[model samples]
Target: MNYVILAGGSGTRLWPISRNSKPKQLSQLVGDLSMIEETYHRLGKNQSVFISTNSQFAPLIKKLLPDIPAENYIIEPDKRDTGPAMAFVAAWMSLKHPNNPMILLPSDHHIRDKRTFMEVIEAAENLINSRQVLINIGIQPTFPNTSLGYLEVGEEISKEAGVHVYEFKRQKEKPDYKTAKKFLDQGNFFWNVGSFAWTPNKFIEAYKKFAPVIGDHLNELIHDLESGGDGSEAFSRMEKVSIDYAVIEKIDPRQVLTIRGDFGWADLGSWDQLFDQLADKADAEGNLVKANWHGVDTRNTLIYGPADKIITTLGVSDLVIVDSDDALLVTPMSRAKDVKKIVELLSYKKLQQHL
Candidate 1:
């Protein structure tokens, strides 16, 4: 089996600390090792791992994972979404390891326990090998997280599927409070964690059924590979789309399965998320601190970054304060989701240096 780490996100939500040059995947948000390093370490032994990242970040990936072969770095010349990204990898892997199962993963996610993660991946791999089914490792829903999409299971055929294969139900964007609560109460839904596994043939079939554009491109790529040609030029012809929209939602209901992942998983997509997941938290005064803080009445706030900065917060609650040598970010926790908007505003204002 091959593990494909999809590490192309710019991490717009984690700006300043996570910049254009150094996105969240390459940052040590949770610990000393960067998220990518953690991901590489967590991957079990005796498996080939590939990283699909933007061409711009290739050098950093090399520095981080020096042992990873140059051929394993599938650098994208342009920013295509997940669907095209998957197509490219699928084609590449199909040519090299045609029958091998491929696991798709996002590089920046935080998983607290590696043991349970390994168990889940092994189970998923077994199912993939046995049935040749397209699988998604679903996170057991802990909350009515409107931020994530929910996967509803259908029936239980094998004991492995406590519930049946996952049904590609309607995809819901962030829902209002009431709707989210309803999903939580329903008890059958799991958060679409986005980790996937499938044989190369299954991937091509799904892409042809759902995303014809990518399917055609993959076919052309295959033809080019057969003619002893490089795929770069052919890959450029495709339109970028996400795997969720291009394949998962459109596939036949019974074809895809969702394996429950018991590992401690966190998306770490926003400032508040990172704050809540921090290993340490300060007192009742609401002064939440990590690695850097020296002050009084720094109430109900989150602060992280260099210790030398001497970040002193006075009378601040529900605020996110992140400091770095090159940039500083100060924003209310309530508006954390709008951090990407700030990135956009900065871009429009021609502040590339800060990005």
Candidate 2:
């Protein structure tokens, strides 16, 4: 199976540290390795791999993955969401590795237990017989998180899917707090981790059958590429939507399957999530610190800054303080979701430099 990673994200929730120039996936926030590098290394060195990113961070991707051939860099001219991007992958792969099953991974996610992660993907690969099915790698939820959507799982069909591969019941899209808690209590929900595996021809066929708008755009792109016409420009005008919203949720229930990923997975989209996932990075007082900080009676807080700057906290608890070279973000731990709003406010104020 060939692996492709989606590396486009408008860094918003994790601002200050993540900007338009560099999103969290490209940042070395968790370890010595940047998130993308970590993701590549987690997959074995023997597999064929590709990265799908927009024009902005293509240089950094090139610099990081020098061994990857120039042709493998699937750089789109502009940012369209995952729907168009996945369609692009299928269209490109049909021209290149036509028969290969493609495993799509999110460019930025903290996945502990790489062996278990691969075990899940490999299991998904084994079961992928046609385009009628795309196996979603679902992480068993550890908490009632309202920020993420849930996958309701049904019947298991294979030995590999002891409980891993199951009929996908329905999507519980970012449910209310009460509903989230109810899902957690129900014990059948898995967090939609955005990792999927399926063959290109089949996936593209499924797209044409389900999402005609995206399918038409994919057809146009393929036609343009073959004719040596302006394919990228045509792709740029395609509707912006996510693969999940456009196709996955809309597909016949039999078209989607779920495989259990045993790894500890978390999409570090918000400060609080970042703090929670890297629990080892925190002190006993529940404070996760990266920057120069002198704390006085601080507990359950995260303080981080760029280089050579000291951020001091006084008698504060449950807060996130980050100092980027151009911006400073300070918010309560509970309001981690509001960071995206702050990014919006910056855009509204025409503070382009800060973003």
Candidate 3:
């Protein structure tokens, strides 16, 4: 099997820390290593891996993974979203290895249970080989998250595949509290983790069925890819769309299957999400600190950074105070979602340096 790492997100939602040039995947958000590096390590042995990213990230990735082949990096011409980028990847792979199966993964997600994650991938690979169906790895939702998209299983493909994935229902965009509870009660919904697996030929066929323009461009795009063109033509010619809208969501019910992901996963999209994952539960004062720190009246707050900087808090509750040498962020937990608004406001005021 081959691996395609989709690494072209701007990570606008995680601004200040994640900038346009340095997205969250490149940032050291969760652990000591960058998310991309961790993603590379998590994959099983003996798999050809391809990284799809923009030009800005190319050199950085090369520096990080010097052992990886230079040709494995698939640089997009522009931000055309996942569908087109994935089409290009599939088409390219088809030209070289049409029979080889490919696993598509986002570069920025945090996967905690790697062994279980690999098991899910193995299961998907087996299903693809035996049943010739495209697989969508869907994570079991741990909370009522409004930020993520959900997948509804249509029917069971196999009773003993350990998981039964049916047809993918239309996406529910950030459901209200009542609707979210209803989904949970239904017990058939799974969080769309965006991980996918298919043979190169299967991928191209799916694209041709759902997105003919991208499928038609395969030959010419592959030529440009081989010749190492500037990527101007391909980017301009391809339509900007997501995989869900262009293919999976649009495909006939019989062509798809959903595989439940038991691997602990998080998109790492927001600080609040990170808080939920990393906050020390043992802190009695509700003051979560990564390094050495002293606190006063700082309840239900998170502080992350160096031990030298004494992030002293007074009369602050339900807040997130992060102190980096280049930037300092102080916001109530409820208002953390508005950080993008802060980014926009900062941009409007011509505070480009801070951005």
Candidates' C-alpha lDDT: 0.78, 0.81, 0.76
Q: Between prediction 1 and prediction 2, which has the larger TM-score?
A: 2
lDDT of 2 by residue, 231-274 (tens): 78667866788888877888788878888887888788889889
Cα error, residue 344 of model 3, in Å, equals 0.9
Clash totals in order: 2, 1, 2
Write down the RMSD of all candidates, one decimal each: 2.5, 2.1, 2.3
Instruction: Give TM-scores for every candidate, taking all chains together and pairing residue i with residue i.
Output: 0.91, 0.93, 0.91
Best prediction by lDDT: 2
Residue 162 of model 3, lDDT score: 59
Residue 257 lDDT in candidate 1: 79
Would you list the rank order by lDDT, best first? Answer: 2, 1, 3
For candidate 3, the clash count comes to 2
Number of colliding residue pairs in model 2: 1
Better of 2 and 3 by lDDT: 2
**Which ranges of candidate 2 are over 4 A from the true structure?**
129-132, 161-163, 227-230
